[model samples]
Target: MSSIFESIEHAQAQLKELAPNQWNAFQQFNELVFKEGALSVKEKEIIAVAVTHITQCSRSTDFHTKAAKKAGASLKELVEAAFVATAIKAGGGVTHGTHVHNAKKTDASDFLYARSNLQNLKSIGKNAHEGFKGYTQFNAAATTEGMLNTKLKEIIAVAVGIATQCPYCIDVHTKKAENLGATNEELAEAIMVSSVVAAGSSFTHIAKMIQSYND
Candidate 1:
């Protein structure tokens, strides 16, 4: 039986063949994103690893994991990055759940995202309350300092938020990261890293497209 996932070794020639200009452009952008600046290549790769987890792209995960290891990321550091992704992903659900309360309010503004919306979580259904508490514990544990520092974890969270495209998370974690002393340059690099990896998740699947066409 053929596997759905294409190996890392699979050629992307078919994709490049179909759109050489766009593919080449993406390559250039990807190269620039990984270049050392405020964040080292290793730091960028670790962010890519976290974004892959959020995107649930095995190809990106494999690619970034190896790149991270090659850049001297320890197993512990990579795992720490992954857990940050986990916390960010779970955070989206909890933050969005506030919509349930906002939906019931007759006076609620047309605006979808607001700091006030977070208040609704306190009124979340009892059935979900315990689960929410469990998530809170896990998120705290995952985000607190371990192999990675709190500032780096928050930076990873910012990147995952962008990858996951959660406005609340982007807003919340960006602030958290800033408060934790993450610089403008650092956050900018984090966003670019997220962008490339998110695109790469789709880019890697071109192999599957090639396989399907042949079969």
Candidate 2:
């Protein structure tokens, strides 16, 4: 008897009709990503490559490796694209935590101290991938927003990855955004979104403090 995934693979191969739920979900999501988007076929393939990395979905990565080549992407370019994803991913972590902690304070109350504290947290987020899985869903979901035009949004996905701190998302979006034409300069610029919002979010601390005072 074959394993469940094998059965799905066989069904997927034969166009037969009996696959498992996880298998089905994967297949359905694959269809959605490929069939309906403003992105091109090669673009989607590259995104899929990144998705596999961020999701840490082994099979998805395998599929995209083949697909990217099929779509005419060079192996070296694909690797470089993935590198771009990782670099931005490293920076996004701090931006996210700083954003989170900052979003909780208001009126510059402890703004200076909080900025310092958050800087520490952001560093933790970036490196959390060494032995953690805190923010993959958060980052991966954000990475799905490939619809925007500015390179900033792409880097924002890295920031999201930082917030969530998932290596997989970091891997995928870094590459996907680049393949979508995010230059190194553009990639660097994209990360600025994290800085802007993270700093601004500190101002939200006011609302939190007010709510606490009322309580």
Candidate 3:
């Protein structure tokens, strides 16, 4: 009987044989995206680890966790990156509550189309809204000048938003990153980093499934 652990190698070999061109292209793209550019290779790998966690890519989590370590990211820095993703994911839900609070008097359909009515949140849920403000401040503090600067943290935020498929977050962080002097090239590279990690996650998980089935 085959072991699940051995299937990853087998699946990769089969993929390369079945679609050599596509496989090669993907490999090339991955190599290109991780190269040092607007963002350093170390910074890119740190962002990759964050995106992997947000995408919940177990395989990628393993890969990037090691890559980040190799790139000289300390364990504290890695933990901070993970928390940035956590903060954004939680904040997305909380911010959306503005729409919900505003729609209380309207029909349910109105809630679906409601934009962020933050003012309404202030009026309707003062305490909770204050808590939201506190969270926003915390998020700002977390991403500011520290082991990771604001610009890089915002780049990481944009990548996380893209991986999580949160438009609000993408808009917010992309603009914030720009304001903090992140060039278009840097932004594009950050997004590309996310794309590769997300795609890699899918391939690796499928490999895991194949391994299980063969076992």
Candidate 4:
């Protein structure tokens, strides 16, 4: 058996040979997304690093971390971004705990995601107050102003929430980010960064696919 963790570069040449036009288009789009816009290149790379964690794309994490550093992001900023990802990802489950209370044999529409569902968390708080309290405290600490401001952290959270596909997180964090004065352009950029990184995560796995085919 061979290691599944093969280098993406090895497969890139193959991909280009197989689909030169699509590969070139992807390259251009990726470059454009990482280039300066509403967010700095540093900010976009940091967002990439943060999102790679939730996507669990080790290769993307390594690549984006280097890109972020090259773009002048400090180690502290990267770590802070990562923590924001952590908090947002974990928060999805915690917030979704509300569904447990309303579970039943019904249509999906019956359980539509309303922000009001978050109020059901009070029950979890009453039943598992200590654990719930602890998690909330950690979430607060992770997202609070530190090396990164609340706004940037919220933006990073939005990106992670998108990658994680956590509608609850998206709703909460986007509003929080807006309250912190994150512009629409900044939010759009964050959404696109998440979108591209998620796509890149799958793209880099072509190395594994190539290996499997050979095996």
Best by TM-score: 4
What lDDT tens digits, residue by residue, belong to model 3 across residues 127-152? 66677677878787767677777788
lDDT of 2 by residue, 99-176 (tens): 555555674455443334544454555666753344545444433433333343465455445434555445556776
Reference-based lDDT, each prediction: 0.89, 0.48, 0.80, 0.88
How would you order the candidates by TM-score, starting with the best?
Answer: 4, 1, 3, 2
Identify the runs in model 4 with alpha carbons over 4 angstroms from their true place.
Answer: 1-6, 104-109
Candidate 2 clashes: the total is 12
**C-alpha displacement of 41 in model 4, angstroms?**
0.5
Q: Lowest summed lDDT over 10 consecutive residues: which window, candidate 4?
A: 1-10
User: How well does candidate 3 match the true structure in TM-score terms?
Assistant: 0.83
Q: How accurate is candidate 2 locally (lDDT)?
A: 0.48
TM-score on alpha carbons, each prediction: 0.92, 0.42, 0.83, 0.93
lDDT of 1: 0.89
Residue 19 local lDDT, model 4: 82
Cα error, residue 22 of model 3, in Å, equals: 2.6
For candidate 2, the per-residue lDDT at 58 reads 50
